[model samples]
Target chain A: MKAVQLKDIRKSYGQNPEVLKGINAAIEPGEFFVLVGPSGCGKSTMLRIIAGLEEVSEGELIIGSETANRLRPNERDLSMVFQNYALFPHLTVEQNIMFGLHVKKIAKSEQIKRCKEAAEMLGISDYLMRKPKELSGGQRQRVALARAIVTHAPICLMDEPLSNLDAKLRARMRSEIRQIQRKLGITMIYVTHDQTEAMTMADRMMILNHGEVQQVGKPLDIYNNPQNTFVASFIGSPPMNLTAAHVNKGKLQIANKWNIKVDGYQDGEVIIGVRPEAILPANEGLPAADVKVANVEVLGTETLVSFELEGNKQWIAKWPGQWSAEIGEILQVSVDHNKIELFDAVTGERLEKTHSKKVLEVVL
Target chain B: MSLPQAQQETQSFVKQRWLGNSRRFASLLEGLLYLLPSILLFTVFLFYPLMKTLYLSFFYSDAQGVPLSFAGFDHFVQLFSSSSFMTSMKATLLFVLYTVPPGIILALALALLANEKLRGIGFFRTIFSSTMGMSVAASSVIWMFMYNPAIGIANRFLTWAGLSEIQWLLDPGWALISVSIATIWMNTGFTFMILLGGLQNIDSQLYESAKIAGVSRFYSLRKITLPMLSPTLFFVITVSMINAFQTFGQIDILTKGGPMETTNVIVYAIYKDAFINYNVGSASAQAVLLFFGILIVTLIQFKLGERKVHYQ
Candidate 1:
């Protein structure tokens, strides 16, 4: 197995604008790296560039310690599974799995051996003689995976290979793919728009937006500590609650309502952020706020209680299940003082908690 | 019931009567009305002529195409046994063999070339597909001049290459071949346009997958491109085979069934018997045979080729 290094990788479309700015990341051998973003965020473009399907405008692509910018896709000895499966519609499942072997002119016996093994591994031995059109979407996906794995390439590039499946199948396949990756120990760079897939499957995930690298770190690390406003708003499922606030010497005023002793550092104007699960009911310890409940979503295991702090600023507390609250119920909710994140009001940049008073400017 | 409910009940009664039982008959009328124009055209131009041709095939007819007496099976028996009619069938088969397979291959080649991305590629595509817009007669006349035995551009090139000057349409051996060449040239553009459309409809990701699989471009073409394009190829082959048997204009202009009857295709044979020689009964019989020949050929193609065609 080999590692993948992308140094100052940038891509530009013709005359419109740059789609990917200089992105740098090193994927270790056997790492399941995920590149994620919203639509048109250049994640797919990056995948295509790595696959050698699209030319990169500028970068050094180092695969196994060699400059790979000039190598063809096949020459790079990597395999890719496409989002649509991209199976040969006319070929039988066995033939599809053994396509690379056939192309490489391997011995006929070797080809048959690999095909048989792959078919059995994928649990598609019964479908060996059937064409891709005859298989369901999940079966076709298995065939695609089997095809890639049979090649035994050290690097595997998957472009959202599980995106086309139904939800239940997708969740099941997600873990199956992870297990497979671990078994093979191949460096896989997967591109997806789903944060769940990225968070659940990646060894490390990179968040891209507007061609810029917003954050890149271990999934849980990035979730717990975001680099900026975008990462904070993007990572969690019902992301962190952020509201405008004015901070002065041990006092926090949010819309002139919920006052808190959030001391330490930044004075003047700031943005306060806290995760939904971090907020608790009034008597349940920590710093508290008197709020009017706006809505409540009771999702079996937990009820997400959303409320207004003042007139328009809505905040949410993810209360544990079966704890029902009525509409317009004025409940005292506590914002976890330790979990509070402060950011510069105008810059959308997280402020260091210790940058403090007598300091006219809070460093952005 | 209130006044409005009473009125609504009466309206519902009327609605049910108008829409429930009578709706079928009204929809039938509407469907027939929609089909009327197509039916009228098919009857006048296709159905009536097909029926008349079948009827006309069984009788001895006057020069004016009117039946004079019952010829029965005599015309068919005579036409089948005659050396001239049999020769016409052989020549027609040769013409098909010469023009069809190569036509498809050449058309597919041109389409593949045109499918590439390059500067001014559309210019080449327009030029390659130019013959689809060419009139059959205009192409025939142009090819005729090129096939001229002496001092034509074709012979000039042959001699310039140190090869002997050869008679084209004038030679008995080369007459059909010469006509087939012109027909192929005239047909390549249409077939190229069709195959190009087929190539465009193929998912581009298949090629990318092939590239990732480390397959050569040629391998991908044989395994993926051809099989994926089989539906379009089936259609092109069927149409070309039918068009080949029905070919008359190019042969008529270039050979006129001359050069010891080497280019006397069935259509030309039919033309000669009906108009030039005034033998309407035999001509009708020949035409009927040609119709069956086309039908059998097309059915055979579909039956054999469709197994490999992948629609998606």
Candidate 2:
């Protein structure tokens, strides 16, 4: 296993703006590190730079203990699984798995042994004689995984390897990949645009937006304490609800209706973030107001109710169990005082909470 | 009342069946109408000549190319026994061997080079494929001048290299090889363009994956590039072989089946017999044989070669 460190990594095309502007992260050895972002956010470009497929405009890439900026992709002693599987369409699964071994001139017996082991690990042993076109999408993904693992490279890079699979298959492959990474103990740098993949599969995840790192930490840590509004809104399923508000003299005002005392925040316009699950019905938490429901979606075991706040901001609350309310009907809702997050409205940076002193009141 | 009603229904059902049949026939006629133009052209140009050649091969013909009497496979038997015909077959086979493999290999090499993503690559691509735009007659004339024994660039280069300048197109031993060289040069352009297209169609991620696996350039070319390019290579080989077998222009322009008939390929031999010597029966026989030879060769290629072609 090898640790990879990127210091001030920057990339740009000729006379164009930088796609990755000064990204820095140290991926520990044997860790499942994922670079998650939206499309065109330079996540794939960063992966390619680390794979040496793209030139780094400015950075120091240290693989293991050596500076590897000048190394060719082949000399990097790594394996990469492309998004399209990249299997030799002419070669059978067995040959595809053995290709790297053949290139490295391993012994024939050893190559076969490694190939068989990888095939069995990926549950693709039955397809060893079949070409990639003959395999289904999920099976082809397995073959690509087998090809990468059979090489026994210390580092493996994957570029959205599960994006092409269906939902159920993607979920299955997610755990399968995590298990394989654990079993092989290889340093994995996986790039994905799906926040759920990064949240579930990564040992440590880095959330990026607009070519800059928003936050990097353990999944749960980043979820509990997002560094900025982008990370907050991006990490959750329904996403954190962000609405315009203001704080004057350490008291928060929402739509000029509710005022909650959130200590240590200065008097300025702010955005408050609350997870969909954090909002409760009026009887369960501190009652804020009875707002007219904009929409209600009963999802059998749960419900998602949307309420239109001031400035036409739609705030959705995920409630446990089925709860139905007519559109435009008044529904009493409340906010969890400790769950509210504060961020600067202009810069979107999270305001640090100094002390736990929350007092809620409705100014209506 | 019941009997009259039943009869009326039966009459209407019969009319409906007739209408359905006529509709089917009308559709068949419409399909035939759409295919009439191509069918007429093929019958006049391809099918009729083919049948006529096969028919004339079994008869003796007059100088006006009219059949006189049934020869009953005597021409085929004579051709099989004739040493000059045997030499023509050998020359044609040798020409195919000389042209197809080397021509394809050279084109493949040039295509691989041109497939690289570099600045000004379009210029090189245009230069490499320029020969394809030149007409065969024109290129063959150029080769005719170049193969001139006394004043041609070929002999001058030989003399400059301190080697003796021998007759190129006039020499019986060197005539076929000289023509094969010219044919390869003229055919490379088409082959290169096709192979380059095939090379471009390959997904570049495969190479990047190979690169990460620490494969050398030659290893990747052997394992990835060759297998991916097999389909195009097979096509080029088949076409170049057929073209080499049917080569006539350069031989007509430069060698003219002269210098002991060493460069007399089957097609040129057939032309000479039919038009020059007016031996229509034997020329038709030769033409028929050439057709079957090409057919069998192509069938064999499809049988064996297609099994290895990797179509992705």
Candidate 3:
């Protein structure tokens, strides 16, 4: 298996704006990469392009060291599991699994052997002779998986293969697919909108929005250090709470309160973002903001309380364990100063510490 | 038990039974009210004539639709034994062979051709299916002119191709074939429509997946398209079979059961017996036999198709 490299890939339909706007990435051999985005974000289209189902509008698609622009889908030697499973409904499970083998004209005995191994790996061995309609949604997904894997292709492209299953089944299949990918040592490019799947299954992920690449990095790295406000808000469940504030006279001015202090030379407006879990109950005399609780939802061991900032923009605080916070309650919540992320209000670009003025003293 | 309590229980049961009977009667009346029109139409147009034909087959009947005397299996026996009856049966089977399967195949081919994503494809589809709008008489007349041996365009083409023009609707051997061809052409449009609907119903994902698997187009067509289309094909086959056996208008207009009775299909024979010969018993017997023949052919097609139709 060789690495897949895409260079300045751009795809547009007719006169419309490009769906994938000059994307460049080099996926290493045997890497599990994910393309994640919201609906209509063209993540599936990217996967289809990689599978040779779509022609690139303009770019080089180097699969296994050869330009794949002119190759047919089957000639590209990549197998794809579609969002709808796309199993042949008329074919039995075994026949569906061995479809690629028959296409390549493999020997019958070997085809059966390989089909059995793939089905066994997917745990759908018992349904070999049954048609796809007889199987449940999850089983159909496994058949889709088996069909892809039985081809023994070096690269597997899965476009939301578990989207049709219930939440629990989706979670289970997520880990199973990852494990199988690692076991087979195949390069896999999975496309999904589910952040949990992106964070859990992906070794490296590229977050996309509005046909542009937002960020590409390891999951936790992207979670802890999102490059911009879009990544900050899109990578987490409750996402990071963002509010516009001004830096004036070496003090952070938020909603008429100038309490927090750090040495900075700028007196300019900025958007500050913090994760919901990074906000805590105010320390005895620390800088804090009074927030009116909007909604409180308790899920298992955690409580998510949404509150309005002084500007009336909503922000969520994820409190660990049970906490007594009623609706309309005014509470002082202290932000974790170290975990804060700041971006330019106009450009939405992250400001690096090297670019920031050195701190001399805390005015507080 | 207390005397008053037992009396109350028995009285309640009697009252409940009366109410239940009244509700049942009301519901029955309402059901019949809804079914009245269909029942009346079926009796008048379908069931009554079916039974009348069956009844008339066993009795001697004269012209003008009047029963004369009892005829014990004589008409049926005569129908089975007569050379002319045998000839008509042969003609019917030959017509079916000429039309039904080829009719289905040609229509399917047209449907497949029309079922493209190319621009203005709907125009071709409309042209292919426009014959469905034509009546039997209208199509027969048009085909009649086309089959004209001397001045028809068909003969014109034959002469232009440097071949002698053969008789289309007159010669004994060619008459059945010519009539069958015209009827098949008239009937292909509906079959094409049905098969096109079937083709549209099949999931396009199957074709895409086959393409991904490196299957050839013909293999995909055979393995995927044909299997998925079996149910619609079965319906078209059944309809064509029945229509082929019941062919009358085209034969009457084009062939007139002429040229030594070569194109004398069973329907034309029954028409002759009832109208020309005034033997209503023989006519009814032949009609009854035609019904059973169509029934058996349909059942056989269904029996073969049941194993193939993947409804989903």
Winner by TM-score: 3
How are the candidates ranked when ordered by TM-score, highest leading?
3, 2, 1
**First chain TM-score in every candidate?**
0.93, 0.96, 0.95
Please write out the lDDT profile of model 3 over residues A112-204, one tens digit for every residue. 998999999999999999999999999999999999998888999988888899999998999899999999999999999998899999999
What stretches of model 2 exceed 4 Å from their correct place? Answer: A102-105, A245-263, A267-269, A289-295, A310-313, A327-330, A353-356, A359-363, B1-37, B62-64
Q: What is the lDDT of residue A293 in candidate 3?
A: 93
Kindly indicate the candidate among 2 and 3 with the higher TM-score. 3
Residue-wise C-alpha lDDT for candidate 1, range B105-132, written one tens digit per residue:
9999999999998889999999999999
Clashing pairs in 2: none
User: Candidate 3 chain B — worst ten consecutive residues by lDDT sum?
Assistant: B203-212
lDDT of each: 0.88, 0.90, 0.87
Span of 10 residues, lowest total lDDT, candidate 3 chain A? A355-364
Q: Which stretches of candidate 3 lie over 4 Å from their true place?
A: A15-17, A244-270, A283-285, A310-312, A344-364, B3-7, B10-34
Which candidate number would show the highest lDDT if scored against the true structure? 2
Instruction: Encode model 3's per-residue lDDT on B1-312: one tens digit a residue.
Output: 999999999999999999999999999999999999999999999999999999999999768878889897998999888999999999889999999988999999999998876889999999999999999999999988988987788889989999988798888879888887888789888999999999998877677677788988888889888988988888888888888888889888888898799999999999999999999999999999999888887888788777877777
Kindly indicate the candidate among 2 and 3 with the higher lDDT: 2
Give the per-residue Cα lDDT of candidate 2 at B13.
100
Candidate 1 RMSD computed on C-alpha atoms after optimal superposition onto the true structure: 5.3
